[model samples]
Each structure stands twice: as structure tokens, then as C-alpha cells.
Target: MSKYKLFLLRHGEGAWNKENRFCSWVDQKLSEDGVKEAQDCGRLLKEQGYKFDLVFTSILSRSIQTAWLVLEAMGQEWVPVVKSWRLNERHYGSLIGLNRAEMAQQHGEEKVKLWRRSYDITPPLIDESHPYFLEIYNDRRYTTCDVPIKDLPRAESLKEVLDRLLPYWNSTVVPEIRNGRTVLISAHGNSCRALLKYLEGISDEDIASVTLPTGIPVLLELDENLKPVKPRQLLGDQAKIQAAIKKVEDQGKAKPST
Candidate 1:
């Protein structure tokens, strides 16, 4: 096993996720397939002899549950976990409950694509009238954050997500990594993408094409400075990994079912 390592696992398919909805920060539970996915990810980690020193997860249930399932599979259920808003999924703002295919139909496909993948261009922000606004505002989790409730973001571009994420990486993750811990992060698609953008040094333009699939654990063996020493390893059968990658890439495409 590598000495300094990190595991990034996007949560399994959430309820909204199964519906192909833009489920960011909406706090949905895992779907049946998602639970199985998370359990299998854990079994893979155990079979591969991986042990995490600590875990970091978003406050959202899907991410949180994924982490729990992974640890239980490892029989390391007692490991510490830090749940932070910084690790939350990129807020989709007004697009929260909308299905991707429907959204692509309503707003041209290209515009929807940019909104989903563009580093700098964000979807429209959620107004105070949106239900997402009232939900988060009333949720006790936000109270843990030092910032005022009004200052929390309603939407975020990938660039903005990276900006919020890097501080946590710099302050919390990097230090623990440098200290030689095997870190596991259970987070959302966009948040992990932001972390990958920093670790891989991908450019603003290139990140648009990068897709991280749910329930797959990406293992990174980093050098002292945290650059990948080798290609990322997906801890599963090759065919399964390929299929998961395909599912993620298709999340942006126009589907006839919708």
C-alpha cells in the first residue's frame, strides 16, 4: 500500500440522481442501486487492503451515507469523520429539481451543457423565493458555519466551487496528507472535480470535459507535494469502471426518456 494516499468517492445514485435531476445540495437519500454501489465500494476497499486514517464528507445525506457504508465495509466504522459545508456539492441554484433532459429541452442543449460544465459560467442563482433557499436557511447544519446565513451561496460555478474548496484542502486536507494519513473523501461530483482540478493541475477550459462517476473510489498515490505519481486507479473490475464512467459522461447528454 502507498504511504501517502487519498480516496475520492462520489456518493452513490441519490433519489434525484436516479431521476437524472440536478440534485445539488437538495439532501436526497441514496437509491437502492446507490446503497449496493456504496457497499461494493467498501468491499473493494477491504479486499484491496486499504485503510483510511480519517474521512471527510459533505453534510448532505447521500455523501454522508456513502462514507458510512464504506467504513462499515472496511470494519473501520469507528474512524473519525468531518462533515463540512465546504465539501457540499456545487449548488445548481434554480435548476435543483429539474431533470437534465428536460432542462436541455427547455433551454438549448448547448446552454445547459455550459451551465453544467463551464468553469466560470454559472446557472442562474436561486432567489429567496426558491424552496431551496428556505430549506437551507432553516436547516441547522448551516448554523455551524461561521458566516451569516444570507452570505451562503445559492449557486456556484466550478471556479467558485474550487475557490471554496481549496481553502479546506489547504487548511485541513493538505496538512493531514502531509502528516501521512490515508484520507477518504465522500463528496459530490462537482466538489470532487474541483479537488481533481487542483491536484491534477487541469486548466479552466479542460475541466469541463472531466467527469467523476458516483460510487467509484479513485485512488491517488501522491508524492510529497501531492502530484499523482501514477495514473489514477479505480478500485474495481475494469469493465465496471468503464461502465460507470459512461454513465457519468451521459449525465450531460440529451436523453429521449425524459
Candidate 2:
């Protein structure tokens, strides 16, 4: 049997994504451009003749829509997709749906940076008592009643994401790869990074330097031992990919809106 190939994709842009808001755990729909971008991603993958044995996505619509578009492009539209909350984006706590630049303007760049990048620091929890809570809670496919403003694993630094995500990788993903199934993972920035850390065994400090761009696919080739025989490749226009990643880093510095 041929060695299994793993494909990783981040979701297309969302409304908050366009507004430069922190989406984190908040479930938001894709913007018009985001939808087009997703379709373009599928077309690109289709042109490359990529196919998968199984599909996985975070419960969030951005990830889910991206996966669906990709499968449609691959002509595997009927392939079963498993949605898991464990694969969702890092919850941005009180920062959800808030514009980063405005927040920074009110709060200060240094504090915002700490909230955004610190390994274990969690900002304030989003209030379940807030009017938006029911809409948020009910929209989640995998989250439970246990998921409240405070109770939800509210704030998550990338390190915390790695902690929660790695166990799922070990218990679930590793087995799929070893069993010789071609797996396609549609996930968020940090969750994908967490997977990358496990695959590469990267240092905690170094992972901060890693950035994933939206709508790009990363392909991993592994051996019988499931170790990467080659490094990951970011598909599509190289210049566009780099620019996109830079945009993410820039957005992290934006102030929260008033």
C-alpha cells in the first residue's frame, strides 16, 4: 500500500475575520470573500488530484465549510466528515468578536500582546449571561451544556491548545495514519499548529514562531512509522501564502474595538 498522505487546511475568512475581530471560540460564518477563497482552495486541490480516505474538521462552520468545499472539489463530496470540538480554535475568552486594534488602543499594546501571546494567560471569560450566549452555545455542534462563559475552557494560549489537542492527536489521529488512511484535517490556526508541533516535535518556545495562513493546504508524507519523511509544504502562490501569514501576525497587534 502507498504511504498515507495527510492534508491540513485552515478555514476561510469569517465576518469577524474581515472586521479584524478575535474569533477564537466564537462561531462565525464565512464572509463572501472567505467563501470564494474556500472554493478557490478546493479548485486548487482538485487540480492537483488530491483525495482523502477520511475527513476531519472543527465543529466551527468556517472549518466545516472549508472541508465541504474541498471534498466537493475532490469529487468526494459524500465522504463522511467527523467534527470535533477538540479541533476548534483557541478560545479568545472575553476577546471574542472584539476588534483587536480598538482593544489595544484602550488597553495598551503591551497588555494586548500579553493577552494574545502569553503561554498560559487567559483574558476574562465571555459572559454566558450576555444576550449573545444562547446563540453562541446553541450554534456549537460538539460543545455541551458544560460549555458556559466561565466553564468553557475559556482562555487558551497556543501552549494550552497544544496540551488539549495533543492527546486527541495521539488517541485519534495517530491511529488513523498508522492504519493507512489518508487523512485531511480542516482546523483553526492554533489547533493546526498544535498538530504541527506533535508531528515535528518542536520546542515550546519555538512554536510561537510558527504561523499558518488561511485557505492553504499543508501536505505531510510519512513513513510506516508515521514519521514525516519530508517537511510540510504550503500549497498555492508562495508569495500570497507568506503575505497571508504576515497578516495574521499583524492582526494580533490590533486594538480591541470600543
Candidate 3:
């Protein structure tokens, strides 16, 4: 057997996703179309005869549902799953619940574009006293190195997501790969980007430009040494994937609500 195959996927669409709101670390479930998309993704994997040895997902429902659907499609619904906050989406900070169009109207399209697209820049952090913050912090199912609310109540740059997520990859994910288990990761866009930056050895500036589409599985084959054995293989209709990513990159470009 090869070293191990890593199947990466960004979660399917969410309700808030359709509304053009920032969903970073927010617990939104998959939309109806999102569920169907996940099923289609699973069917694609099955058609390719792909099999998974282990599965992982962020603590959020959307990611969890995507993983479940993929595994079901692969006919490995019984596979063990590991859920971790380290796999959570990039924290969107102050933009979490705000409407994108309204924000653009208030903040101007140019400024909103910078907030949404700039790789290293972070939006304003959310207040610790905010209701969402308290709910997330108190949720027993969510785990972090420490109280995220106390230390990080705001948005995170892509760089920050990498710093936090990489350690888990090195310690948890690498060992599995070394042991020759194929791993499937169901996570967020920026989180997948974080892992890709590490696997592909892409630079910070370049990583900012990398975008992964929703519900599209990326196949990364590694050698015996856990190095990439092949260029990534992206599944699904290419046109649809491209459009979804464009939407993400254009998060704040839409006209604001009057």
C-alpha cells in the first residue's frame, strides 16, 4: 500500500453561507443543496473506488455532516471520526453575524474587500461579552487549548489558522499517515488552505491566494515518507467548483442592503 491518501474537503454550503455572512467558527448547518452536494461528492468518490481508513472533521455541524455524507457514499459509514476545534473554521471575529451587503454599504466595498480577501489581515474581533461568544465558550463539546473567548474573541488571519491547526496535523494527522492509513478531512476553506500550505510547502504570500471550493474533495497521495506522491486531484464539476470559490473570494464585493 502507499504511504496513505489524504482526501480533503471544504464543507458544503450553509444557510448563512447563502446570505453572504461570515461563518468563521460559527455553528451553521448545511443547507438543502449542501446535503445533496455532499451526497454527490460521496457518489463521485465511490465511482472512483476510493476508500478511507480514518475520518476527521471540525466541531461545526456543517463539517460534521459533510464528513458523514462522504463516508456514507464511500460505504464506510462505520469508520471512526475525530472531531476537534483545531479543525474549526477560521474565526471571523466581528464579521460573524453581520450581513455582507449591509457591511459593504456601511464600510464601503473597497474596505470590505480588504477585510474579506487580505490573507494576513484580520477583521475586528468579537466582544467576549457577546451572546455568541458566551454560548460557544460554554459549550462542552467544543475544545480548545484554552478559553478562546478569553484569548481570541475576534477574527483571525489565514496565518493564524495555520499556526493553530498545523500542530494538530503534525502530531495527530502525520502519525496516522505514517501508519499507512488513508485519512479524510472534512473542514473549512481556510483550514484546508492551512493544511495545503504545509503539505505543498507554499509560501505565506502564495497561500493567501489559494482557494478551495465547497464540497469538492481534493485527493493528495503521499509517498512512504509522507511526502506528496502526486499533484492534488480535485473531484466534482470544475465549473461549479470555480464558481463557489469565486463567491468566497468575493465575499464583501456585493452591494450592501439599502
Which has the greatest lDDT?
1
Full candidate order by TM-score, most accurate first: 1, 3, 2
lDDT of 2 by residue, 186-207 (tens): 9987789878887877786677
Candidate that beats the other on lDDT, 1 or 2, i.e. the better one: 1
Candidate 1 local lDDT, 1-258, one digit each (tens): 345789999998898888888889788999999999999999999999999999999999999999999999889999999988999999898988888887777777898889988999888898878867778678988888857778888899998999888888899989988887889999999999999988888898999888888899999888877898877787888897888778866766776544
The model with the greater TM-score, 1 or 3, is: 1
Question: Could you tell me how far off, in angstroms, the CA of residue 220 lies in candidate 3 after the best superposition?
Answer: 1.5
TM-score of 1: 0.96
What are the lDDT figures for the candidates, one per model? Answer: 0.88, 0.79, 0.81
Question: Which digits, one per residue and each the tens of the lDDT, describe model 3 over residues 1-258?
Answer: 346688999988888878877777778899998898889999999998888888889889999999998888878899889988888898878778788878888888878766665677877877776557776666666545444545643668877888888888989988887887888999988889878888888886777577787888999887776678777888878788789878777766657443
Against the true structure, what is each candidate's TM-score? 0.96, 0.88, 0.90
What TM-score does candidate 2 reach?
0.88
Off by over 4 Å in 3: 1-3, 129-131, 143-153, 256-258
